[model samples]
Target: MTSLLFVDDETKLLRILSSYFTKKGFVVHTASTGEEARSKLRDADARIIFLDLRLSDATGIELLQEFVPRYPNKLFVIMTAYSDVESAVTAMKAGAFDYVSKPAKMDELEIIIRRACEWLDMKQENRTLKEKISKMMQDQEMIGVSPAMKRVFRMVERAAETDATVLLEGESGTGKSRIARMIHRWSDRKNQPFVSVNCAALPEQLLESELFGYEKGAFTGAHAKRKGKFEAARNGTIFLDEIGEISLPLQAKLLQVVQEKSFMPLGSNQTVHVDVRIIAATNRDLKTMVEEGLFREDLYYRLNIIDIFIPPLRERKEDIPPLIEQFLDKQRAKYNKPFTLPPELIDRLVEYPWPGNVRELENAVERAVVLCRDEQLSIEDFPREIRHAKPDRPPSDIALDPTKSLPEQLESIEKKLILDALEQTGGQIAAAARLLSISRQRLMYKMNKYSIR
Candidate 1:
């Protein structure tokens, strides 16, 4: 049953109203002073408070103002004298549900309470709907049963335990960005902002400004001071997607942020410090870029503290069925056309090498959902490319390391030694650096270089 509270100095009215409401199946509470009423409001689960306009301690309007903003789910009805119409209007503006003049009929009071309950219920329902929509908008998740994904899951769990920089390396559209989100969601900073910037998507000029916020009037069109992703992700994680595509100058700024935990925004003189965890993802080989002098060595070392190499979807064929089912169900729900793929269609889909990876598979499923005439999707319903696609080669057929040169092999060995030393000493950088015969800063740079997280 819903609870109701009557806050009035009038002992006679409070007694009568309390008895009437209790008999009508409401759990009634009464308080004389404003202070007593406030205590009751906090302690009790009253949905509607029938508040007197004038109390011994304070006016009902004042109490209404204090509580309306704090407890929006609860309704406050002003019980005012006929001459206090102006005060009643003020109470309404301050978020009171309604006003009932003194000596009001029981029928009118009941109707007002009923209406307020309905409105509160509607607001709660609307909030629930919005939450569902938000989850749908950020619906991407990993779906795989392969050993490769099992390893990725273990890596995710390990990375979640600490606030280390993580680098997700994979082919384009292989769900590296989604895995970044998974890492953030599982980390200690999950409650804080998870800001992401795609280095390849923005121009060099704008990308620098977007990472570190600028002061007001720092640049043309800079009308107001705006906080960047770094500031916004305070005590949280900031994901840099397609990080390898970032310009060399911007990489220098990023290296400073990683090394010193500070950076000056574009067009700003003052340096802003931030304590944020970084998670960067890229398809490009940072080692190759570093060797070619296209990428900064220091920045590469800083970003590559903890590396998670995600195998492309084509390399994990065993995961295809579950991935297809998940995508099909999602697209069916989205398009309002629930359907199932035929056995032959499923076989063909699993055989077709997903060159675009998970992204391409999702598109294929959506396309099938939109064009299928019946509940059972056939080969003809799929895209032309998918229908005629060749089978993918086994993972064993491909190169395990993929780096074919002596320097690249040594680079791989050096990364392993650094990671092994860090692990043996439980992430004590100075000790790990000593074991690797490198300075502390050098080891730090090396860990960042290889992204040992």
Candidate 2:
């Protein structure tokens, strides 16, 4: 329920307002003095506050200045008996949501309160929506808006509309997994689960069990019956990441499942039929693997029904600006910090060759955000590696010098790298962090440790 607080020096006015608001389905509290009002405010969960300008000890405008900053979400309305229209305008400028003269109009006050409630609800909903979108984007695990990425997005949209198996091929960190998720989000099964299994992270037997669950006694450590990725992704999308890493035997089994849309558990005699849409991703050359007789050609054909190839970060430098803006907005909201990037940094970012692709860029930005100390992110906030990154320099120039007593040389190199990255990323901490390949929090700690101002 919405709560309202009324503060008035006149006992009758306070009682009447409180009763009226309470009768209109609001939980109302009353205070006759500024001190009393403050105390009540501290104790109650009030969403809307009515402050009397003629408080016994303090002016409503003064209270509003103090209150507004403390409770930025709460709506405040000022009331005054003095016929001074100037005071009301000043109160409004001081953060009062609205103002009312003494002998309040019940209808007008009710309308204002309703509007305030709606405004508050909208603010909360917008915050919630932004958070949800942020989370979804973060999970995609890629960042960029370059032309290549735009093409990749178009492919994802097209892939989502059909039930065809999609094969995402790209170098590691090029955001193959992210593309798979994009397809899932845009597909008809968007509301359903999107289960992911890393093909390279597990051994053959374990991988099999993970993809097609086993009975409780299928293996030594199988303590209970389990549901595998295929089952988990029933009526949804199943992402097979690093598909090139699976063994020959496993590949055959996977092919059978892909063709037949059914599989039996490792130790179970019963067959499990499932309706799962396959979205496989790999960083290796599947054609080479097939020619070497390591991968099943049939499986490749099955998954290649709709193929999407994401370009590395070096290939699409144009997307850096939007990605930087996206990351900066996220960091600012997350850290509750106010910092902006300069345009010069964008030029530097576009010039760099991101070997690690979009993932690397995001890490760099995160680093800058945490390490930045001033209102504006400057070149000084970046990591040492990124700051010192020179386009034409040999790999040796970029490497840390082992000759000059490791510590001293390392510090010198660190200082240079941070400065260079900051300069390149245009003072975006998050972007700098990505360039440095470190967490934003870690970057902040190092900046403090080395005194990299």
lDDT of 1 by residue, 1-453 (tens): 889999999999999999998999999999999999989988999999999999999989889888888887898899988898788777867877677778888987887777777768878865654453344235656765676876787687789898888889999989988888888887788898899898899998888888898888988999998889899888999999999998888888889988888988767888889999999999999999999998999888788888999998878988888888888778767767768877877777778888899999888888887787888888887888877777765565223466458778778777877888989866766446657765555777887888777
Q: Which ten residues in a row have the lowest lDDT in candidate 2?
A: 139-148
TM-scores for all candidates: the values are 0.56, 0.55
Residue 449, model 2: lDDT of 82
Per-prediction RMSD in angstroms? 24.8, 18.0
Give the Cα error of residue 285 in candidate 2, in Å.
1.3
Tell me the TM-score of model 2: 0.55
Q: Write the per-residue lDDT of candidate 2 for residues 103-195, one digit (tens) a residue.
A: 878987887788679879978865654554455467634454455665676677678899899999988877788778878887899999999
